[model samples]
Target: MNFEIVTELSHLERVCEQARKVPAVMLDTEFVRTRTLYPRLGLIQLYDGETLSLIDPIKLDDMSPLWALLTDESVIKVLHACSEDLEVFHHYSGVMPTPMVDTQIMAAFLGHGLSTGFAALVDEYLQVSLDKGEARTDWCARPLSDKQLEYAAADVFYLWPLYHLLAERVADAGWNEAVNQECNLLVSKRGKTPDPEKAYLDIKNAWQLRPQQLAVLKKLASWRLREARRRDLALNFVVKELHLWKMARFDIRSLDKMVDEGFDRFEVERHGSRLLRMVSELDTLPEEHYPEAIVRLVDMPGYKQMVKEIKDQTNAVAEQLGVVPEFVGSKKQIHQVLKWAWVNGRNPEKMPDLLSGWRKAYVEDRVLPLLK
Candidate 1:
């Protein structure tokens, strides 16, 4: 029940050295980053049942030991819903935890699916209600209160036991092999930066736009992405989705027209004339210069049939497993699996890293067998 709070690098190193001797550790991170490019680690909690250590990354200048623990091939790193947490570790320490056991993934093996939030998992499995009132507390603030420390401690305190329970459940259900295979990949792969050329696909009007409009959309989207990364601002803060969709056509030749059309509401209004000029330049470029194939993916007639199959199969799979369908997989992933299947003439598992955990499960259980 006692947890040690470490605020200095020397203390953190000593704690990590001791932790490295252990077989496994339960880990959780509390960070503040809504306004920044990278999350600021406010608190990091690691527990090994008998001992708990809470690290203050703010006071600690060196975390190389903790990073070493993450990269240690022999020790298993345990977490729940580790995507953002993985990103945080990679950003700050330049290491992704290897040989991880994500309870979230194991929960899906028990049919809880991916939508099970952390508090909900604790409540359901551990029979404890969590105080999420401090969920949005600013982690970057100095002099973290006792309540904040308690909240942070709660995250990892139960993780050790939770992983034990889920590991057994997954093994009993004969899913450990599949799940471990995935965890290995998560541990080994370095996260890749998104390609700028494909960034426009995230735009709201990407699928609906014509080839010419898509070319313009790509240019503007690239500009927005670069600006957001350069200024370390949220994408919406630079330019809203509707504004980008409206400008995708780039038919408005004048800055005044854009202002009259509500583009002026953007905080980047001062850059209006300059942005208009950029769009105007894109307007002059040939549509052929853009990857017309990407826009064509959404319009292919085969996609409609794949959409229907994905919906029916996903729901049926969820029903068979006694879980909600959306948690099983998303419509977009379903489409991607089918598209990949068509080209590869093999299992959907052969698809690029685009397939999420849900897709992998669906492909292994349902789609692959049906393909035969």
Candidate 2:
């Protein structure tokens, strides 16, 4: 339970220097992201199996030493469920840790199932229960409570032992290389912000819109995301998704119509005119310029049969490998592979995710031949 609070540059430099000597170090971050697009990093916990240090980024301005340590290839950075931690590090430092080992990935490969919580892993491997009460605390606030510090420290403290256990188990199972590649792929996928033009694709029920209506929805979705990023505000704070879809759906012209269509009164007042202008300007667009009506995969010919065949084969592979089916392939990933197979005027450069990285060995021989 004893840990050092590193708040000075010299202390951080010394800590990183010492950590560089280790073969691997446990790492974790505590941040707040209630409303903003980017996480506000609060504290960093690093444990080299000997020195458990809580480095306060709020106190230090120059984090070059820590950043260098993160990018060091000789030292593996071990983390549990590190998706957001990867985002926080990539956004804040502009670099991600290398030679990474995600304990969650190892656990999944070891048949614990994907999306396992860190506390759950710790309890199973280390026989210790973690207090998750501080999960919603304001991490950006100064003078973080001892309870908060203790909670954050616990994130990395148990990781050291758990990494050892899981790594050995994964290696003994002969899935170490797959685990490493999965970790690498995980790092590569972090921090990919979609372009504004394609932002509308993420809207739910967007496919129901007509071609011209889809065009208007695209414009609003683009503007909302652009404004959100520019102002660091949440997308809903700028304009609710319902507002965007409604503003585009029925082709509301007047501000009153907007409010009638369930647009928040404040949003209508603040953005109604701009939104109406975007829709009105589209009136001049040639019919050919409008986006094509979205074609849902379920509505496509042979989509259900293709999905069923692939899902069945994937399940067989997972059963043979003695792993969770989710670890083999999730529904989203199946859709990615199917969409790539279709190549119906989408990005030509994008490869099927199932045909790449660790997934390829499991999928290419067993399942993808069906697509052919």
Candidate 3:
């Protein structure tokens, strides 16, 4: 339970030096992103088997020492449900921790369940309950309370033992290669800048729009993404998805029309003209330039039966392997596989993730046959 509250640069360097000697270090980050496009780091917690260090990112002027330790491949970095924590690290160091082991990923591979929360895993595996009272604390605020520090320390404290337990389970299951592949993919994907042009695909009810409208949606979504990042504001705060969908579906001639359609007054006043201009430019798009219609599988005649068959085969194979069907292939991934199959004349060259790597052995063998 002995820990240090590190607020100075010199102390952080000394702690990192000590941490380098450890084989593995448990890592966690406390950050806030309520009003910003990027997560604002507030605290970083590290437990290196012996010392639990609570490093205050808010007070520490430079995090280079800690960043070096995190990016060091010699020492394995351990985390639970690491996606967001990885993002926090990327925001600070512009790179993800290497040779990382995510207990959550290991838990899923070991039949613990998919996307299990950290607290739930701790309770289930170690029979230890974690206090989540400080879950919503303002991490960027100055002078963190003793209770907050204790809660933060607890996040990394159990991680060391949990990592060993999960590692043992993965080894027993003989899935070390598969688990390592997944962890590597997780770290590589962290801090990746998403394609703005593809942002339109995430809008709900987007499939209902025509090809021309889809083009407009793509442009509007791209604009929104750039604006959000440039202004460091939430995407929804800049312009809600609902408004985007409405704009794509309807013909709004002027800014006045946009306001009537439930667009925020300030947003309409600020960026309404640009949105309209983007939509207007889409009118000049060539016929071949328009985006393809997103045809839902259910709407495609006879494809519904194909989807069901694939799901049944996937589920049967998953059950036989003693794993969840979604773990083998999620519904979205199944749909993607089917879409690729249909588009490519039933060729299996570009199969989805479920049909690749270790998943192929469990899922593709059964599902691919159904697709044929």
Which candidate number has the best lDDT? 2
Better model by TM-score, 1 or 2?
A: 2
The per-model lDDT (C-alpha) reads: 0.75, 0.89, 0.86
Q: Put down candidate 1 lDDT per residue, 54-94, tens digits, no spaces.
A: 88888888888889899897888998888888878987887
Candidate 2 residue-wise lDDT at 329: 80
TM-score of each: 0.85, 0.95, 0.92
TM-score of 2: 0.95
Q: What is the lDDT ranking, best to worst?
A: 2, 3, 1
1 against 3, candidate with superior TM-score = 3
Candidate 2 lDDT tens digits, 1-372: 889999999999999999999999999999998789778899999999899999999999989999999999999999989999999998889999897899999998888879899999888888999999999999989999999999999999899989999988998999988998889888988857679999999998899899999999998899999998898888998998987888887889999898778788889888989999999989988889889888777787899999999989889888888899877888988888877777544454776677777778778886657777
**What is candidate 2's local distance difference test score?**
0.89
Q: Between prediction 2 and prediction 3, which has the larger lDDT? A: 2
